[model samples]
Target: MITVLIRLLTLRAENVIPEVIWALMAIYVLAVLVTLTSVWVTFKKLEGRLLWSLIVLLVPFLGVIAHCLYCLTHADVDVLKQFGFFTRKTA
Candidate 1:
């Protein structure tokens, strides 16, 4: 098990495509940035902000998806508006 992990970690330079590697890294950075900003802006309480920040940072893509799902189902419209997510005027 340990040997397999070490082998995976020690990837040869020849085996990787530089463009694809940079693209994936860029996507990850963008995702983390957007998710962290969303978490900070949407949650009013400090603990909520901190907890979601940690979740998104530590868990990667799945954490961003989870936070989005939670917000869609659980967040108030006013809160989302406060975060500048909703811009259309309400009747």
Candidate 2:
């Protein structure tokens, strides 16, 4: 069993990660990063790091909407100290 594992592990790296897969993965990661950054910037300071991060990372697009709604509803955190949809116009 060890020999079989060793043989597979020794195979060429190119065969393991195809070019198209790599490109797609890079794009996906970039999108996730951008989305996460947007969430961070929009909220200014997110309370309960674990819950917010999980919501954003787990659901991607829908997570953004949910987080925005959460920001609107939750009053504990300063959701208007930075880039908020309503705060900018009133200022």
Candidate 3:
């Protein structure tokens, strides 16, 4: 195992493309999973449901984080209001 690890660490520059592609594919799969889980739990209202769902499916990496933050703030307005500094009420 250690020998294989050493060989990977010494990969030539030309071999990096396939490795990068695989890494990106893995990240995309993870983002899809996150988006699916969010659909099951977070988004309920019909307002931005389709829009946010598309965003989560299309943008790489940060889409999941964005969806999660949206869900967080939407679901916990009171929690944020308790902090006072974290929430601004619109007049």
Candidate 3's C-alpha runs over 4 A off are 1-20, 75-91
Clashes of 3: 0
Off by over 4 Å in 1: 1-16, 75-91
Question: TM-score per candidate, in order?
Answer: 0.63, 0.42, 0.49
Candidate 3 per-residue lDDT, tens place, 2-71, comes to 6444545777555455556686688779878877677756657765677776777788667788877776
Model 2 per-residue lDDT tens digits across residues 1-91: 4654454467755444455456657777876676677566655455755567778798867876777677567743455555554554543
Index of the highest-TM-score prediction: 1
What ranges in model 2 sit over 4 Å off? Answer: 1-17, 48-50, 60-91
TM-score of 1: 0.63
Query: By how many angstroms RMSD does model 1 differ from the true structure?
Result: 10.5
Global lDDT for candidate 2?
0.64
lDDT of 1 by residue, 17-68 (tens): 5555676688889988998999998999999999999999899789999998
Which 10-residue window of candidate 3 scores lowest in summed lDDT? 1-10
Error of 1 at 31 (Å): 0.8
